[model samples]
Target: MGTLRDAMGYPVLRAGIILLVLALLISIAGLYRVDKSYSSSGTLGEGMHYLGDDKFENEYLYHNRTLTLSSTNATISLLQGSEMYNYTLVNDSVTLHPEMRPAIYVFNGEVNYTYDARAIDYPYAVYSIGAFVIMLAGIALSFIGYTQFLKDVKGGKK
Candidate 1:
Protein backbone atom coordinates (compact mmCIF):
# COMPACT_ATOMS: atom_id res chain seq x y z
CA MET A 1 0.00 0.00 0.00
CA GLY A 2 2.85 2.42 0.79
CA THR A 3 4.43 1.61 -2.63
CA LEU A 4 1.29 2.92 -4.33
CA ARG A 5 1.21 5.77 -1.83
CA ASP A 6 4.73 6.98 -2.81
CA ALA A 7 3.40 7.61 -6.34
CA MET A 8 0.41 9.40 -4.70
CA GLY A 9 1.22 12.51 -2.65
CA TYR A 10 0.80 12.39 1.12
CA PRO A 11 -1.93 15.08 1.28
CA VAL A 12 -4.33 13.47 -1.26
CA LEU A 13 -3.85 10.03 0.22
CA ARG A 14 -4.56 11.45 3.68
CA ALA A 15 -7.87 12.93 2.49
CA GLY A 16 -8.87 9.63 0.89
CA ILE A 17 -8.00 7.81 4.09
CA ILE A 18 -10.16 10.20 6.10
CA LEU A 19 -13.14 9.62 3.83
CA LEU A 20 -12.61 5.86 3.96
CA VAL A 21 -12.60 5.92 7.76
CA LEU A 22 -15.83 7.90 7.90
CA ALA A 23 -17.60 5.51 5.54
CA LEU A 24 -16.44 2.49 7.52
CA LEU A 25 -17.64 4.04 10.79
CA ILE A 26 -21.06 4.75 9.32
CA SER A 27 -21.39 1.18 8.00
CA ILE A 28 -20.54 -0.28 11.39
CA ALA A 29 -23.09 1.89 13.18
CA GLY A 30 -25.80 0.80 10.78
CA LEU A 31 -25.35 -2.85 11.76
CA TYR A 32 -24.94 -2.38 15.51
CA ARG A 33 -28.37 -2.50 17.19
CA VAL A 34 -31.53 -3.47 15.35
CA ASP A 35 -34.98 -4.14 17.00
CA LYS A 36 -38.64 -5.07 16.36
CA SER A 37 -42.08 -5.64 18.08
CA TYR A 38 -45.39 -7.51 17.90
CA SER A 39 -49.07 -7.72 19.12
CA SER A 40 -51.93 -10.21 19.79
CA SER A 41 -55.67 -10.73 20.56
CA GLY A 42 -57.80 -10.85 23.75
CA THR A 43 -61.35 -10.81 25.14
CA LEU A 44 -63.18 -7.81 26.65
CA GLY A 45 -66.53 -7.67 28.40
CA GLU A 46 -68.95 -5.54 30.49
CA GLY A 47 -68.85 -5.69 34.29
CA MET A 48 -66.72 -4.95 37.37
CA HIS A 49 -63.99 -3.24 35.33
CA TYR A 50 -60.42 -4.62 34.97
CA LEU A 51 -59.59 -7.54 32.68
CA GLY A 52 -56.45 -9.64 32.07
CA ASP A 53 -54.82 -8.57 35.38
CA ASP A 54 -54.83 -4.80 34.69
CA LYS A 55 -54.58 -4.26 30.94
CA PHE A 56 -58.25 -3.65 30.15
CA GLU A 57 -61.05 -1.62 31.76
CA ASN A 58 -64.81 -1.05 31.75
CA GLU A 59 -66.58 2.30 31.60
CA TYR A 60 -70.22 3.16 32.23
CA LEU A 61 -72.15 6.20 31.05
CA TYR A 62 -75.89 7.06 31.37
CA HIS A 63 -76.67 3.56 32.65
CA ASN A 64 -74.95 2.03 29.57
CA ARG A 65 -72.04 -0.38 30.01
CA THR A 66 -68.96 -1.25 27.92
CA LEU A 67 -65.78 -3.31 28.28
CA THR A 68 -62.27 -3.26 26.85
CA LEU A 69 -60.48 -6.61 26.60
CA SER A 70 -56.78 -7.10 25.93
CA SER A 71 -54.77 -10.13 24.93
CA THR A 72 -51.06 -10.91 24.63
CA ASN A 73 -49.38 -12.66 21.71
CA ALA A 74 -45.79 -12.80 20.49
CA THR A 75 -45.12 -10.01 17.97
CA ILE A 76 -42.36 -8.54 15.79
CA SER A 77 -41.87 -4.84 16.52
CA LEU A 78 -39.27 -2.30 15.32
CA LEU A 79 -39.78 0.69 17.65
CA GLN A 80 -39.47 -1.05 21.03
CA GLY A 81 -36.13 0.48 21.97
CA SER A 82 -36.14 4.00 20.49
CA GLU A 83 -38.17 7.18 20.76
CA MET A 84 -38.54 7.28 16.97
CA TYR A 85 -40.87 4.28 17.03
CA ASN A 86 -44.51 5.31 17.53
CA TYR A 87 -47.45 2.93 17.33
CA THR A 88 -51.23 3.11 17.72
CA LEU A 89 -53.35 0.41 19.45
CA VAL A 90 -56.46 0.10 17.32
CA ASN A 91 -59.03 -2.64 18.00
CA ASP A 92 -59.35 -4.84 14.93
CA SER A 93 -62.30 -6.78 16.38
CA VAL A 94 -64.36 -4.76 18.86
CA THR A 95 -67.73 -6.37 19.37
CA LEU A 96 -68.88 -9.78 20.63
CA HIS A 97 -72.57 -10.70 20.61
CA PRO A 98 -74.41 -12.40 23.46
CA GLU A 99 -74.33 -16.18 23.59
CA MET A 100 -77.44 -18.47 23.31
CA ARG A 101 -77.19 -19.55 26.97
CA PRO A 102 -78.10 -16.16 28.54
CA ALA A 103 -77.83 -17.38 32.15
CA ILE A 104 -74.18 -18.57 31.98
CA TYR A 105 -72.71 -16.50 29.13
CA VAL A 106 -72.47 -12.84 28.12
CA PHE A 107 -70.93 -10.60 25.45
CA ASN A 108 -67.22 -11.18 24.60
CA GLY A 109 -65.47 -8.22 23.01
CA GLU A 110 -62.04 -8.79 21.49
CA VAL A 111 -59.22 -6.23 21.65
CA ASN A 112 -56.02 -6.24 19.67
CA TYR A 113 -52.62 -4.77 20.37
CA THR A 114 -50.14 -3.09 18.00
CA TYR A 115 -46.61 -2.84 19.28
CA ASP A 116 -42.95 -3.03 18.13
CA ALA A 117 -40.45 -5.84 18.57
CA ARG A 118 -37.49 -5.54 20.94
CA ALA A 119 -35.04 -6.94 18.37
CA ILE A 120 -35.04 -7.74 14.69
CA ASP A 121 -35.17 -11.41 13.62
CA TYR A 122 -32.34 -11.29 11.10
CA PRO A 123 -29.23 -13.30 12.07
CA TYR A 124 -26.19 -11.40 13.33
CA ALA A 125 -23.96 -13.33 10.92
CA VAL A 126 -25.89 -12.02 7.90
CA TYR A 127 -25.72 -8.40 9.06
CA SER A 128 -22.01 -8.73 9.76
CA ILE A 129 -21.40 -10.05 6.26
CA GLY A 130 -23.25 -7.09 4.75
CA ALA A 131 -21.29 -4.63 6.86
CA PHE A 132 -18.06 -6.26 5.77
CA VAL A 133 -19.01 -5.75 2.13
CA ILE A 134 -19.75 -2.06 2.75
CA MET A 135 -16.40 -1.57 4.45
CA LEU A 136 -14.55 -3.15 1.54
CA ALA A 137 -16.36 -0.91 -0.93
CA GLY A 138 -15.46 2.16 1.07
CA ILE A 139 -11.77 1.23 1.16
CA ALA A 140 -11.83 0.46 -2.56
CA LEU A 141 -13.33 3.88 -3.32
CA SER A 142 -10.59 5.57 -1.29
CA PHE A 143 -7.86 3.70 -3.17
CA ILE A 144 -9.46 4.59 -6.50
CA GLY A 145 -9.56 8.26 -5.54
CA TYR A 146 -5.93 8.11 -4.51
CA THR A 147 -4.93 6.56 -7.86
CA GLN A 148 -6.95 9.09 -9.85
CA PHE A 149 -5.21 11.93 -8.03
CA LEU A 150 -1.80 10.45 -8.88
CA LYS A 151 -2.80 10.00 -12.53
CA ASP A 152 -3.74 13.68 -12.78
CA VAL A 153 -0.35 14.67 -11.36
CA LYS A 154 1.62 12.52 -13.88
CA GLY A 155 -0.26 13.71 -17.01
CA GLY A 156 0.34 17.39 -16.11
CA LYS A 157 -3.28 18.05 -17.15
CA LYS A 158 -4.77 19.18 -13.79
Candidate 2:
Protein backbone atom coordinates (compact mmCIF):
# COMPACT_ATOMS: atom_id res chain seq x y z
CA MET A 1 0.00 0.00 0.00
CA GLY A 2 1.20 3.52 -0.81
CA THR A 3 1.81 6.12 1.85
CA LEU A 4 -0.34 9.29 2.39
CA ARG A 5 2.40 11.21 0.56
CA ASP A 6 1.53 9.26 -2.59
CA ALA A 7 -2.07 10.48 -2.36
CA MET A 8 -0.79 14.09 -2.61
CA GLY A 9 0.17 13.36 -6.25
CA TYR A 10 -3.51 13.07 -7.27
CA PRO A 11 -4.20 14.95 -10.53
CA VAL A 12 -7.48 16.42 -9.24
CA LEU A 13 -5.70 17.87 -6.23
CA ARG A 14 -3.08 19.51 -8.45
CA ALA A 15 -5.72 21.12 -10.65
CA GLY A 16 -7.66 22.23 -7.60
CA ILE A 17 -4.54 23.87 -6.14
CA ILE A 18 -3.98 25.74 -9.37
CA LEU A 19 -7.57 26.91 -9.45
CA LEU A 20 -7.40 28.01 -5.82
CA VAL A 21 -4.36 30.12 -6.57
CA LEU A 22 -6.01 31.62 -9.61
CA ALA A 23 -9.13 32.40 -7.59
CA LEU A 24 -7.01 34.18 -4.98
CA LEU A 25 -5.38 36.30 -7.64
CA ILE A 26 -8.75 37.08 -9.19
CA SER A 27 -10.13 38.10 -5.79
CA ILE A 28 -7.65 40.94 -5.80
CA ALA A 29 -9.47 42.37 -8.79
CA GLY A 30 -12.71 42.28 -6.84
CA LEU A 31 -11.16 44.75 -4.41
CA TYR A 32 -11.54 47.47 -6.99
CA ARG A 33 -15.36 47.34 -6.60
CA VAL A 34 -16.30 49.40 -9.61
CA ASP A 35 -19.74 50.82 -8.99
CA LYS A 36 -22.18 52.21 -11.51
CA SER A 37 -21.43 55.82 -12.34
CA TYR A 38 -23.59 58.35 -14.15
CA SER A 39 -24.50 62.00 -14.07
CA SER A 40 -28.06 62.69 -13.10
CA SER A 41 -30.11 64.21 -15.90
CA GLY A 42 -31.06 67.83 -15.24
CA THR A 43 -32.98 70.70 -16.81
CA LEU A 44 -31.95 74.26 -17.46
CA GLY A 45 -33.82 77.52 -18.00
CA GLU A 46 -36.10 77.86 -21.02
CA GLY A 47 -35.76 80.19 -24.04
CA MET A 48 -32.49 78.43 -24.84
CA HIS A 49 -30.86 79.98 -27.84
CA TYR A 50 -29.84 78.20 -31.01
CA LEU A 51 -26.10 78.88 -30.87
CA GLY A 52 -23.97 78.72 -34.00
CA ASP A 53 -23.17 75.28 -35.32
CA ASP A 54 -19.43 75.95 -35.36
CA LYS A 55 -18.87 77.80 -32.05
CA PHE A 56 -20.30 78.39 -28.58
CA GLU A 57 -18.86 81.55 -27.05
CA ASN A 58 -22.34 82.63 -25.98
CA GLU A 59 -25.54 80.57 -25.62
CA TYR A 60 -24.27 76.96 -25.52
CA LEU A 61 -24.08 75.33 -22.11
CA TYR A 62 -23.12 71.90 -20.79
CA HIS A 63 -23.50 70.80 -17.16
CA ASN A 64 -23.60 67.48 -15.32
CA ARG A 65 -23.29 65.52 -18.57
CA THR A 66 -26.23 67.48 -19.90
CA LEU A 67 -26.09 69.72 -22.96
CA THR A 68 -28.59 72.53 -23.22
CA LEU A 69 -29.22 76.00 -24.53
CA SER A 70 -29.43 78.57 -21.72
CA SER A 71 -32.21 81.07 -22.05
CA THR A 72 -34.96 82.47 -19.80
CA ASN A 73 -37.70 81.71 -22.36
CA ALA A 74 -39.26 78.35 -23.38
CA THR A 75 -38.88 78.93 -27.08
CA ILE A 76 -36.56 77.11 -29.56
CA SER A 77 -36.72 77.26 -33.33
CA LEU A 78 -35.98 73.98 -35.12
CA LEU A 79 -35.16 74.94 -38.68
CA GLN A 80 -34.67 71.31 -39.69
CA GLY A 81 -34.97 67.91 -37.93
CA SER A 82 -32.89 67.80 -34.74
CA GLU A 83 -33.00 67.03 -31.03
CA MET A 84 -33.01 69.71 -28.34
CA TYR A 85 -32.97 69.80 -24.53
CA ASN A 86 -33.46 72.67 -22.09
CA TYR A 87 -32.70 73.22 -18.42
CA THR A 88 -34.45 76.00 -16.49
CA LEU A 89 -32.50 75.41 -13.27
CA VAL A 90 -29.15 77.01 -13.95
CA ASN A 91 -27.22 79.23 -16.29
CA ASP A 92 -23.96 78.74 -18.22
CA SER A 93 -21.60 76.51 -16.20
CA VAL A 94 -18.52 74.49 -17.16
CA THR A 95 -16.80 71.50 -15.57
CA LEU A 96 -14.63 68.46 -16.23
CA HIS A 97 -15.63 65.06 -17.47
CA PRO A 98 -17.18 62.53 -15.11
CA GLU A 99 -15.63 60.06 -17.57
CA MET A 100 -13.87 61.25 -20.76
CA ARG A 101 -14.16 62.50 -24.34
CA PRO A 102 -15.02 66.15 -25.10
CA ALA A 103 -17.43 65.95 -28.01
CA ILE A 104 -17.77 68.68 -30.60
CA TYR A 105 -21.41 69.74 -30.80
CA VAL A 106 -22.80 71.74 -33.70
CA PHE A 107 -25.97 73.57 -32.63
CA ASN A 108 -26.97 75.10 -35.95
CA GLY A 109 -29.50 77.75 -35.02
CA GLU A 110 -28.21 80.22 -37.52
CA VAL A 111 -29.57 78.96 -40.84
CA ASN A 112 -31.82 76.71 -38.77
CA TYR A 113 -31.35 75.44 -35.20
CA THR A 114 -30.73 71.71 -35.02
CA TYR A 115 -29.48 69.99 -31.88
CA ASP A 116 -28.37 66.35 -31.86
CA ALA A 117 -27.29 64.28 -28.91
CA ARG A 118 -27.27 60.69 -27.70
CA ALA A 119 -27.45 58.83 -24.38
CA ILE A 120 -24.83 56.34 -23.24
CA ASP A 121 -25.07 53.42 -20.83
CA TYR A 122 -22.24 51.55 -19.11
CA PRO A 123 -22.21 48.10 -17.45
CA TYR A 124 -22.25 47.97 -13.64
CA ALA A 125 -20.86 45.23 -11.35
CA VAL A 126 -19.92 43.00 -14.31
CA TYR A 127 -16.30 42.69 -13.27
CA SER A 128 -17.17 41.90 -9.66
CA ILE A 129 -19.70 39.30 -10.74
CA GLY A 130 -17.21 37.64 -13.08
CA ALA A 131 -14.57 37.39 -10.36
CA PHE A 132 -17.11 35.95 -7.95
CA VAL A 133 -18.04 33.24 -10.48
CA ILE A 134 -14.42 32.18 -10.89
CA MET A 135 -13.94 32.03 -7.14
CA LEU A 136 -17.07 29.93 -6.73
CA ALA A 137 -15.93 27.50 -9.40
CA GLY A 138 -12.51 27.18 -7.79
CA ILE A 139 -14.08 26.52 -4.41
CA ALA A 140 -16.26 23.79 -5.87
CA LEU A 141 -13.28 22.19 -7.56
CA SER A 142 -11.26 22.32 -4.34
CA PHE A 143 -14.04 20.63 -2.41
CA ILE A 144 -14.34 17.85 -4.98
CA GLY A 145 -10.59 17.37 -5.03
CA TYR A 146 -10.40 17.19 -1.24
CA THR A 147 -12.96 14.43 -1.28
CA GLN A 148 -10.98 12.63 -3.98
CA PHE A 149 -7.84 13.03 -1.91
CA LEU A 150 -9.58 11.42 1.05
CA LYS A 151 -10.63 8.51 -1.12
CA ASP A 152 -7.12 8.19 -2.49
CA VAL A 153 -5.67 8.10 1.05
CA LYS A 154 -8.13 5.41 2.13
CA GLY A 155 -7.44 3.32 -0.96
CA GLY A 156 -3.70 3.63 -0.41
CA LYS A 157 -4.12 2.49 3.19
CA LYS A 158 -5.85 -0.68 1.94
Candidate 3:
Protein backbone atom coordinates (compact mmCIF):
# COMPACT_ATOMS: atom_id res chain seq x y z
CA MET A 1 0.00 0.00 0.00
CA GLY A 2 2.83 2.36 0.83
CA THR A 3 4.51 1.60 -2.45
CA LEU A 4 1.24 2.12 -4.28
CA ARG A 5 0.72 5.46 -2.54
CA ASP A 6 4.26 6.48 -3.30
CA ALA A 7 3.80 5.48 -6.89
CA MET A 8 0.59 7.53 -7.17
CA GLY A 9 2.33 10.52 -5.62
CA TYR A 10 4.70 10.82 -8.57
CA PRO A 11 4.45 13.90 -10.84
CA VAL A 12 3.57 11.79 -13.87
CA LEU A 13 0.76 10.08 -11.97
CA ARG A 14 -0.54 13.42 -10.78
CA ALA A 15 -0.51 14.71 -14.35
CA GLY A 16 -2.38 11.64 -15.51
CA ILE A 17 -5.04 12.19 -12.86
CA ILE A 18 -5.45 15.78 -14.02
CA LEU A 19 -5.77 14.65 -17.60
CA LEU A 20 -8.37 12.06 -16.67
CA VAL A 21 -10.39 14.58 -14.69
CA LEU A 22 -10.27 17.13 -17.50
CA ALA A 23 -11.35 14.55 -20.03
CA LEU A 24 -14.32 13.55 -17.90
CA LEU A 25 -15.34 17.16 -17.43
CA ILE A 26 -15.12 17.84 -21.17
CA SER A 27 -17.13 14.71 -21.92
CA ILE A 28 -19.86 15.79 -19.54
CA ALA A 29 -19.97 19.20 -21.19
CA GLY A 30 -20.25 17.58 -24.57
CA LEU A 31 -23.19 15.46 -23.43
CA TYR A 32 -24.93 18.56 -22.12
CA ARG A 33 -24.38 20.27 -25.44
CA VAL A 34 -25.90 17.30 -27.25
CA ASP A 35 -29.00 17.45 -25.10
CA LYS A 36 -29.31 21.19 -25.62
CA SER A 37 -28.93 20.88 -29.36
CA TYR A 38 -31.49 18.07 -29.56
CA SER A 39 -34.03 20.07 -27.60
CA SER A 40 -33.54 23.15 -29.73
CA SER A 41 -33.88 21.24 -33.00
CA GLY A 42 -37.62 20.72 -32.23
CA THR A 43 -37.78 17.05 -33.22
CA LEU A 44 -38.72 15.57 -29.86
CA GLY A 45 -42.22 14.40 -30.67
CA GLU A 46 -43.56 11.04 -32.01
CA GLY A 47 -42.10 11.83 -35.42
CA MET A 48 -43.73 12.60 -38.72
CA HIS A 49 -46.76 10.79 -40.08
CA TYR A 50 -48.50 10.26 -43.37
CA LEU A 51 -51.06 13.04 -43.51
CA GLY A 52 -53.00 11.81 -46.54
CA ASP A 53 -52.88 11.52 -50.31
CA ASP A 54 -53.90 13.78 -53.12
CA LYS A 55 -53.85 13.98 -56.89
CA PHE A 56 -52.13 16.50 -59.08
CA GLU A 57 -52.62 16.72 -62.83
CA ASN A 58 -54.08 13.20 -63.03
CA GLU A 59 -51.20 11.72 -61.05
CA TYR A 60 -51.37 10.14 -57.61
CA LEU A 61 -49.53 11.88 -54.79
CA TYR A 62 -48.65 11.26 -51.14
CA HIS A 63 -48.16 13.70 -48.28
CA ASN A 64 -45.92 12.90 -45.36
CA ARG A 65 -45.48 15.43 -42.57
CA THR A 66 -43.66 15.93 -39.27
CA LEU A 67 -44.08 18.49 -36.51
CA THR A 68 -41.37 19.76 -34.15
CA LEU A 69 -42.15 21.69 -31.00
CA SER A 70 -40.16 24.11 -28.91
CA SER A 71 -40.97 26.12 -25.82
CA THR A 72 -43.07 28.83 -27.44
CA ASN A 73 -43.09 27.73 -31.08
CA ALA A 74 -43.28 24.83 -33.53
CA THR A 75 -42.23 23.95 -37.05
CA ILE A 76 -43.60 21.57 -39.66
CA SER A 77 -42.37 20.37 -43.00
CA LEU A 78 -44.47 18.62 -45.61
CA LEU A 79 -43.04 16.13 -48.06
CA GLN A 80 -45.66 16.11 -50.71
CA GLY A 81 -46.02 15.71 -54.45
CA SER A 82 -42.43 16.29 -55.38
CA GLU A 83 -38.99 16.70 -53.85
CA MET A 84 -38.70 20.20 -55.26
CA TYR A 85 -41.95 21.17 -53.51
CA ASN A 86 -41.06 20.61 -49.84
CA TYR A 87 -43.30 22.94 -47.82
CA THR A 88 -42.18 24.21 -44.45
CA LEU A 89 -43.93 26.15 -41.71
CA VAL A 90 -41.80 28.02 -39.18
CA ASN A 91 -42.96 29.13 -35.69
CA ASP A 92 -46.57 28.42 -36.58
CA SER A 93 -48.81 25.43 -35.93
CA VAL A 94 -50.74 24.81 -39.10
CA THR A 95 -51.30 21.88 -41.37
CA LEU A 96 -49.66 21.80 -44.75
CA HIS A 97 -51.85 22.63 -47.74
CA PRO A 98 -49.86 21.79 -50.82
CA GLU A 99 -50.85 23.66 -53.93
CA MET A 100 -51.85 21.60 -56.91
CA ARG A 101 -49.33 21.43 -59.69
CA PRO A 102 -48.79 19.46 -62.86
CA ALA A 103 -47.00 16.28 -61.80
CA ILE A 104 -43.97 15.48 -63.87
CA TYR A 105 -42.88 11.87 -64.00
CA VAL A 106 -39.21 12.30 -63.28
CA PHE A 107 -38.70 8.84 -61.83
CA ASN A 108 -40.78 6.39 -63.85
CA GLY A 109 -44.01 7.24 -61.99
CA GLU A 110 -42.47 6.33 -58.60
CA VAL A 111 -41.37 8.83 -55.97
CA ASN A 112 -39.99 8.24 -52.48
CA TYR A 113 -40.75 10.71 -49.69
CA THR A 114 -39.24 11.06 -46.23
CA TYR A 115 -39.70 13.61 -43.42
CA ASP A 116 -37.05 13.87 -40.71
CA ALA A 117 -37.89 16.35 -37.94
CA ARG A 118 -35.31 15.02 -35.51
CA ALA A 119 -32.35 15.65 -37.74
CA ILE A 120 -29.73 17.45 -35.64
CA ASP A 121 -26.03 18.13 -35.61
CA TYR A 122 -23.99 15.36 -33.94
CA PRO A 123 -20.73 17.18 -33.20
CA TYR A 124 -21.51 17.10 -29.51
CA ALA A 125 -21.84 13.32 -29.43
CA VAL A 126 -18.66 13.04 -31.41
CA TYR A 127 -16.88 15.27 -28.92
CA SER A 128 -18.23 13.22 -26.03
CA ILE A 129 -17.05 9.97 -27.58
CA GLY A 130 -13.63 11.42 -28.33
CA ALA A 131 -13.26 12.68 -24.79
CA PHE A 132 -14.31 9.35 -23.34
CA VAL A 133 -11.73 7.58 -25.47
CA ILE A 134 -9.04 9.97 -24.27
CA MET A 135 -10.10 9.46 -20.68
CA LEU A 136 -9.81 5.68 -21.08
CA ALA A 137 -6.36 6.08 -22.59
CA GLY A 138 -5.31 8.24 -19.68
CA ILE A 139 -6.51 5.61 -17.23
CA ALA A 140 -4.59 2.89 -19.04
CA LEU A 141 -1.47 5.04 -19.16
CA SER A 142 -1.76 5.81 -15.46
CA PHE A 143 -2.12 2.14 -14.61
CA ILE A 144 0.93 1.20 -16.66
CA GLY A 145 2.96 4.05 -15.15
CA TYR A 146 2.06 2.98 -11.63
CA THR A 147 2.93 -0.63 -12.37
CA GLN A 148 6.30 0.46 -13.70
CA PHE A 149 6.92 2.52 -10.57
CA LEU A 150 6.07 -0.42 -8.34
CA LYS A 151 8.42 -2.69 -10.31
CA ASP A 152 11.19 -0.11 -10.00
CA VAL A 153 10.70 0.17 -6.25
CA LYS A 154 10.80 -3.60 -5.84
CA GLY A 155 13.93 -3.90 -7.98
CA GLY A 156 15.73 -1.22 -5.91
CA LYS A 157 14.91 -3.03 -2.66
CA LYS A 158 16.23 -6.30 -4.11
Candidate 4:
Protein backbone atom coordinates (compact mmCIF):
# COMPACT_ATOMS: atom_id res chain seq x y z
CA MET A 1 0.00 0.00 0.00
CA GLY A 2 3.04 2.28 -0.27
CA THR A 3 2.24 3.23 -3.91
CA LEU A 4 -1.03 4.02 -5.77
CA ARG A 5 -0.79 0.77 -7.72
CA ASP A 6 -0.17 -1.23 -4.56
CA ALA A 7 -3.17 0.38 -2.84
CA MET A 8 -5.40 -0.72 -5.77
CA GLY A 9 -3.96 -4.26 -5.89
CA TYR A 10 -7.40 -5.75 -5.15
CA PRO A 11 -9.09 -5.69 -8.59
CA VAL A 12 -12.65 -6.19 -7.30
CA LEU A 13 -12.36 -3.37 -4.75
CA ARG A 14 -10.76 -1.02 -7.27
CA ALA A 15 -13.40 -1.68 -9.91
CA GLY A 16 -16.26 -1.25 -7.43
CA ILE A 17 -14.85 2.10 -6.19
CA ILE A 18 -14.38 3.36 -9.74
CA LEU A 19 -17.91 2.39 -10.74
CA LEU A 20 -19.32 4.02 -7.60
CA VAL A 21 -17.52 7.28 -8.35
CA LEU A 22 -18.83 7.31 -11.90
CA ALA A 23 -22.37 6.64 -10.72
CA LEU A 24 -22.11 9.47 -8.19
CA LEU A 25 -21.01 11.94 -10.87
CA ILE A 26 -23.74 10.80 -13.27
CA SER A 27 -26.40 11.11 -10.56
CA ILE A 28 -25.35 14.68 -9.76
CA ALA A 29 -25.52 15.64 -13.42
CA GLY A 30 -28.91 13.98 -13.78
CA LEU A 31 -30.26 15.94 -10.88
CA TYR A 32 -29.07 19.16 -12.50
CA ARG A 33 -30.64 18.17 -15.82
CA VAL A 34 -33.98 17.22 -14.23
CA ASP A 35 -37.09 19.12 -15.24
CA LYS A 36 -37.46 22.23 -13.09
CA SER A 37 -40.84 23.36 -14.32
CA TYR A 38 -43.61 23.57 -11.70
CA SER A 39 -47.11 24.97 -11.64
CA SER A 40 -48.78 27.43 -9.24
CA SER A 41 -52.43 27.10 -8.15
CA GLY A 42 -55.01 29.88 -8.39
CA THR A 43 -58.54 30.72 -9.42
CA LEU A 44 -60.00 31.98 -12.70
CA GLY A 45 -62.08 35.10 -13.08
CA GLU A 46 -64.01 36.87 -15.84
CA GLY A 47 -61.26 39.32 -16.77
CA MET A 48 -57.50 39.94 -16.52
CA HIS A 49 -55.73 38.43 -13.52
CA TYR A 50 -52.11 38.63 -12.42
CA LEU A 51 -50.33 35.97 -10.37
CA GLY A 52 -46.77 36.91 -9.48
CA ASP A 53 -44.57 39.29 -7.46
CA ASP A 54 -42.48 42.34 -8.33
CA LYS A 55 -39.68 40.20 -9.73
CA PHE A 56 -41.87 38.07 -12.03
CA GLU A 57 -45.18 38.64 -13.77
CA ASN A 58 -47.75 36.09 -15.15
CA GLU A 59 -50.75 37.66 -16.71
CA TYR A 60 -53.99 36.04 -17.92
CA LEU A 61 -57.01 37.29 -19.78
CA TYR A 62 -60.70 36.46 -19.44
CA HIS A 63 -60.42 33.35 -21.57
CA ASN A 64 -57.30 32.16 -19.72
CA ARG A 65 -57.98 33.58 -16.26
CA THR A 66 -57.73 30.12 -14.78
CA LEU A 67 -54.20 30.06 -13.36
CA THR A 68 -51.96 27.93 -11.18
CA LEU A 69 -50.87 30.52 -8.64
CA SER A 70 -47.68 30.29 -6.58
CA SER A 71 -47.45 30.77 -2.83
CA THR A 72 -46.85 34.50 -3.04
CA ASN A 73 -48.95 37.58 -2.42
CA ALA A 74 -49.81 38.88 -5.87
CA THR A 75 -51.53 42.26 -6.20
CA ILE A 76 -54.65 40.65 -7.70
CA SER A 77 -57.21 43.03 -9.07
CA LEU A 78 -59.72 42.70 -11.86
CA LEU A 79 -59.03 45.29 -14.51
CA GLN A 80 -62.56 45.40 -15.93
CA GLY A 81 -64.89 45.13 -12.92
CA SER A 82 -62.95 46.38 -9.91
CA GLU A 83 -66.09 47.09 -7.88
CA MET A 84 -67.74 43.74 -8.68
CA TYR A 85 -65.58 41.77 -6.28
CA ASN A 86 -63.45 42.47 -3.20
CA TYR A 87 -60.02 40.86 -2.90
CA THR A 88 -58.16 39.90 0.29
CA LEU A 89 -54.59 38.68 0.67
CA VAL A 90 -54.05 35.82 3.07
CA ASN A 91 -51.24 33.42 3.82
CA ASP A 92 -51.11 30.98 0.86
CA SER A 93 -54.82 31.64 0.29
CA VAL A 94 -57.02 34.29 -1.25
CA THR A 95 -60.49 35.50 -0.20
CA LEU A 96 -63.17 37.13 -2.27
CA HIS A 97 -64.48 40.16 -0.40
CA PRO A 98 -68.13 40.06 -1.42
CA GLU A 99 -68.30 36.26 -1.37
CA MET A 100 -69.03 35.68 -5.04
CA ARG A 101 -69.60 31.95 -4.65
CA PRO A 102 -73.37 32.33 -5.04
CA ALA A 103 -73.06 34.67 -8.02
CA ILE A 104 -70.50 32.36 -9.66
CA TYR A 105 -72.90 29.39 -9.42
CA VAL A 106 -75.67 31.42 -10.96
CA PHE A 107 -73.61 32.88 -13.82
CA ASN A 108 -70.98 30.25 -14.60
CA GLY A 109 -72.91 27.28 -13.14
CA GLU A 110 -69.85 26.39 -11.02
CA VAL A 111 -68.96 27.21 -7.47
CA ASN A 112 -65.27 27.76 -8.21
CA TYR A 113 -62.58 26.79 -10.71
CA THR A 114 -58.99 26.22 -9.61
CA TYR A 115 -55.89 24.80 -11.25
CA ASP A 116 -54.01 21.96 -9.54
CA ALA A 117 -50.27 22.50 -9.51
CA ARG A 118 -48.40 19.28 -8.80
CA ALA A 119 -44.96 17.97 -9.72
CA ILE A 120 -45.03 15.75 -12.80
CA ASP A 121 -41.50 14.39 -12.37
CA TYR A 122 -40.21 13.22 -8.95
CA PRO A 123 -38.14 10.14 -9.89
CA TYR A 124 -35.09 12.32 -10.38
CA ALA A 125 -34.92 13.09 -6.66
CA VAL A 126 -35.36 9.43 -5.76
CA TYR A 127 -32.60 8.35 -8.16
CA SER A 128 -30.22 10.98 -6.83
CA ILE A 129 -30.70 9.84 -3.25
CA GLY A 130 -30.28 6.20 -4.23
CA ALA A 131 -27.01 6.95 -6.00
CA PHE A 132 -25.64 8.76 -2.94
CA VAL A 133 -26.49 5.81 -0.68
CA ILE A 134 -24.87 3.33 -3.07
CA MET A 135 -21.74 5.49 -3.24
CA LEU A 136 -21.42 5.45 0.53
CA ALA A 137 -21.93 1.69 0.60
CA GLY A 138 -19.24 1.23 -2.04
CA ILE A 139 -16.72 3.30 -0.03
CA ALA A 140 -17.42 1.30 3.13
CA LEU A 141 -17.03 -1.99 1.28
CA SER A 142 -13.75 -0.87 -0.28
CA PHE A 143 -12.36 0.10 3.11
CA ILE A 144 -13.24 -3.30 4.61
CA GLY A 145 -11.90 -5.16 1.59
CA TYR A 146 -8.60 -3.24 1.65
CA THR A 147 -8.16 -3.93 5.36
CA GLN A 148 -8.73 -7.66 4.83
CA PHE A 149 -6.34 -7.69 1.86
CA LEU A 150 -3.56 -6.07 3.89
CA LYS A 151 -4.05 -8.57 6.69
CA ASP A 152 -3.84 -11.51 4.24
CA VAL A 153 -0.65 -10.11 2.60
CA LYS A 154 1.01 -9.73 6.02
CA GLY A 155 0.13 -13.40 6.78
CA GLY A 156 2.00 -14.55 3.57
CA LYS A 157 -1.20 -15.02 1.53
CA LYS A 158 -1.94 -13.57 -1.97
Error of 4 at 35 (Å): 5.5
lDDT of each: 0.37, 0.42, 0.45, 0.45
Residue lDDT tens for model 1, 69-125: 233321112121222221223432222221110111122332342221122433343
The alpha-carbon lDDT assigned to residue 154 of candidate 1 equals: 76
Q: Give me the runs in candidate 2 sitting further than 4 Å from their true place.
A: 1-8, 33-125
TM-score of each: 0.31, 0.36, 0.40, 0.41
Instruction: Return whichever of 3 and 4 wins on TM-score.
Output: 4
Please write out the lDDT profile of model 3 over residues 6-105, one tens digit for every residue. Answer: 7776766666777798898888776542211111121223244432223212232232224322222333334446554332333333322244321212
Candidate 3, RMSD to the unseen true structure: 13.9
**Number of the top-ranking candidate, with TM-score as the measure:** 4
Q: How many pairs collide in each candidate, listed in order?
A: 13, 9, 0, 5
Candidate 4 whole-model C-alpha lDDT, 0 to 1: 0.45
Instruction: Give the per-residue lDDT digits (tens) of candidate 4, residues 70-158.
Output: 22333344333334433333335443222111122112111132432222333445577767777877887688768867886787665
Point out the higher-scoring one by lDDT: 1 or 3: 3
